[model samples]
Target: MTSLPEDSPPLIRDNDRDTAVGRLQEAYAEGHISHEELDERLHQVLTAKTRGGLQSALASLPEEDAGTTSTIAVAGGRIKRRGAWRVPRILKVESAYGTVRLDLSRAVIEHPVVDIELQLGTGGAKITVPRDAIVEFEDLQTGWKDTRYKTRRRPRSGGPRIRISGTMGFGRLKIRHARR
Candidate 1:
């Protein structure tokens, strides 16, 4: 079991709380728990200050429904995810001399946060999320040409979060929001 240090701060990240809430919601949606149970768990998750507390709040929940891993790899063609497609918890997109677009406005988001690993070469990748979605880009190592990116909103409550990290070489990575 992964446990936090005893002397460390009791505060947990918002992402953790959101994840716990998402689990409770999933349990309710799957009929694994009743409304009362979901309410109780939501309360506990919202008030959880430590990692142990958060874990306890989600202890009674079942594992998430596993599905096929969504991997989009194209060499000189356009790759796009739009409409009502299911958004995987972890997505991998690799493009070369092509364009990759991931639009999440009407997508089904099972997880509170989505992780993306993008490897681009001489191509471009565009991720279009809802206006309220939270996007965090990090560990972006670019070669030759630096990456050109922009985000308008910070990660906020009630909105799904997207964390993207990876490499781009002589390519472009654009993060834009869908018009409300």
Candidate 2:
């Protein structure tokens, strides 16, 4: 096999491409970039073959903030958050024996990525996300019941990404996208 040129930039992986695309989307959503600029940058990221090319596509975007995080812990009562609440960048929820309800259909979310870490014991959670949001729960572990979420086959573009993780024992997690 012929060796690649020493000056050739390293090839990028799919995850790298995805990360770049996600950053572009976040910049667009936060009004840091115009629609036309987002389109151009996205195109560049998608077609980039090397790490250098990908980096060029994201060179102008600002760095993501570490952001504020809040945690709610309950031993035996329900925890509910609804009706135009402000959502932080990272939210940690721990419930021992009660249901947790979070309604984000009409809430205020300024960040592009929201992480919800749940540690539940003998309880469950119901989460309602915005219609355009994207949800990922690949890191969640359940002991008795599985999570209940009907994922859209094609999620809409330019929405916040909600990542759910942690362990649940003897309970279920029901997640739904809002209708309005």
Candidate 3:
């Protein structure tokens, strides 16, 4: 990914009221945007004072003309699945502020992975792993009460030695070994 320069302008732009309204209408019609959606977007754009706010709203609502695959929500959250698991090689995880991943591990197969190296960006987590699992020490920076892990369920498969490292702000991470 191309990194934006520190001095570069923000992704969200402040649109003039009249021009923005016109574009909203045009996008609503030729773009086939619903009146309700357009109104919501208009409200967001109007209320947004900073470029970040404007950009966030725009990113959440994509251009009507451009779209590929729809998103399916899982575990009361939006999720995406990759290829089927085969011997469970390596799990590549990346995340930003306030986002969590791997919500289906406990729900799906029990202890299907043998090894994992978790490289987190900036976020908090509450994770549970099988008991008797060996974890390795890794280089990481974490915040106070940001990570909590615990294990309650019985162990199905021998959990891999998890090594986690990353920078965090304000959150809690919990890890515990569940006895199966």
- Quote each prediction's TM-score: 0.73, 0.74, 0.35
- Candidate 3 Cα deviation (angstroms), residue 89: 3.3
Tens-digit per-residue lDDT, 1-180, candidate 3: 998789866453322443355456666766657889888877977887666655554553435332122222223232234223222334444444444444323433322223333444445554444355544333445655535544335544444445545554555555555434
Q: Residue 140's C-alpha lDDT in candidate 1?
A: 72
- Residue-wise C-alpha lDDT for candidate 1, range 60-138, written one tens digit per residue: 5777655446788888888888999899988988887787888998888867678888888877777888777888786
Model 1 is weakest, by summed lDDT over 10 consecutive residues, at 147-156
lDDT of each: 0.80, 0.90, 0.47
Clashes of each: 0, 0, 22
As a whole number from 0 to 100, the lDDT of residue 15 in candidate 2 is: 53
Q: Order of all candidates by TM-score, from best down to worst?
A: 2, 1, 3
Q: Quote the positional error of residue 70 for candidate 3 in Å.
A: 22
TM-score of 3: 0.35
On TM-score, the stronger of 2 and 3 is 2
- In candidate 3, residue 13 scores what lDDT? 39
